[model samples]
Target: MTTLNHYHYKRLQEFCSSVFVKAGVEKEQADIVAASLVQADLRGVDSHGVVRTAIYLKRVEQKMINPKAKIRIEKEDESTALIDGCNHFGAVVGDKALKLAMKKAKANGVGMVGVKNSNHFGTGAFYALRGLKEDLVTIVMSNASQTMPPTGGIKPFIGTNPLAVGIPCGECEPFLLDMATSVVARGKIIVAAQKGEAIPHGWAIDKNGKSTTNAEEALKGSVLPLGGPKGYGISMFIDIFSGVLTGAGFGKYVNNMYENWKAPQNVGHFFITIDVNKFMDIKTFKHRMDLYIRDIKTEPKAEDVEEIFIPGEMESRRSEQRKKNGINLSQNVQRELTNIGMKYGVSLKDALMLNHNTEGKGV
Candidate 1:
């Protein structure tokens, strides 16, 4: 059976940073990538966390992706810009794009940035939350490798295509929404398969187009869209914004990094940052948001439901708890991490020793 272990989050982040540096990535770029991955883990989005780092480094090692890529903006207006990532690590590209969006918003009330020639940027929420920290409403989205189909068709075509939005709420936790257009991110299926677990019904189908609980089969087949055709449309628009509009590969053309070793995945990203003061003062907006949250929470009671949660509330709670206690890693994932560390002459065991390890309840 797949087992679990808990390790201190800070130490884990340090270990990840060191691994990338050893893999020949510049320290600044490596740290940004490492933080983004660990942030995913801390928020319990393990599918996008350190587990995926090994593949990223492998891509770097093969020269399919450039670790020291020159990220530059090819075009811009007062509040909008288009960036060429030069095929760098997605997290580094995302970091620069989000910060630029925030800077423009602060000066011009709103900012929008389009990115091209990037790799997989861990999670949209990572950038969204960064903007949220500056008290701006943020929207982040990306088009990924196609592993899903549109409404009724069979062959894989559309990507999971994730979207994330974060807004500040005065007294309450910010309302955060981050989701994949697919029923689940494809990485989750990869994780389940690694752990020898079956996926839940309605998540994906076999190659023959039949719904199946088999994770391996699901990987070979297509993951179902989030709300059937509705999600298909959403994903299509995301691809338009992130890929087509940004001059990056779209639809069937976006390279899957794992499958296509010939070149880097020309992924794309879109970000929007809005300064609330553009509409009303920050204090007034926060006060209204506080009341709005109260209205929603007061009327929420259903069978077996103890509390109502905002879209990203659960993840925030998970992050807080994990930060205090520790993050859990399945034995399968832990082994993958250790194996990667060994290649870089780093010891995962020593990384864990920074904080005492403990047996924990497995997910």
Candidate 2:
């Protein structure tokens, strides 16, 4: 493991941006994609972070993701919109969709946007947090390639669809809830496989529909839902809104980002923004949220529980700590990033030199 200072991590972003640019992506869009990926790492969501650079780059090379994708509004109204991503990188398309939703929310007090034909959009929180900055409540959802099997099913039929919500408070950090409907995100299994580590039982099932701890077998099989039938229902609900409603690929039709190299992922995303002031005085709402958070944190703790945490509180704390101490990347991730940089004639070692003033090292 190596801890990279924020300064060096920023340089990593710049390097990734450069690589995307060389791959025919627009400079601005490339930067957005890079920032989104790096932000995932900064916030301690390493599964959605730079670990994805190689796959994304490969997708671009395979022409599965259009570097110069032209997203357009397919339908629009005062407070709603439907966007066609034109097979663009998910981060770029997601940014555009969220911005448009914020614009509509500002004017109408609420906004809803559905996006189709997008790629993997990293973490859903990245888009929801946009509304938090504007003092609005935001909800984001997206469908992914098939990886999770429905309750009692043998083979994979649906994705580990995710949901993220961001709500601002007066005196505390914004509340963010971002989660996959599966028992564990597929990326966790991929990371485990990369590190040659075994997974926990109940996380996934082998091809024969038996529980397995081997990460590679899990990947080759199917992930379990978060709460059996309940999670499966939730994932299916998300797919309906993000995939079927948005006219994107649904169920088994969504192409796997890792397995399918030649076809577009055709994933879908949904965003909704609500202006707090419209329902209640913004100040009052914030004050109430702070009070609620206080009560929850100060409540009695069960045995071995140090404290209760509001959703997203721990991640906020992790981000602040990481900003100062630097981000830790696994050796496999480091090697992958280094190889990607070399492919683009950019030396990661040289990039690290840009942050010579910072202190950190591999463990």
| Per-prediction backbone clash count | 0, 0
| Per-residue error (Å), model 1, residue 308 | 0.3
The CA lDDT at 219 in model 1 is 91
Question: What TM-score against the true fold does each predicted structure earn?
Answer: 0.96, 0.96
Q: Give a tens-digit lDDT track for model 2, residues 228-273.
A: 9999999999999999999999999999999987689999999999
**Per-model C-alpha lDDT, please?**
0.89, 0.88
Off by over 4 Å in 1: 1-4, 353-363
Against the true structure, whose lDDT is highest?
Answer: 1
lDDT of 2: 0.88
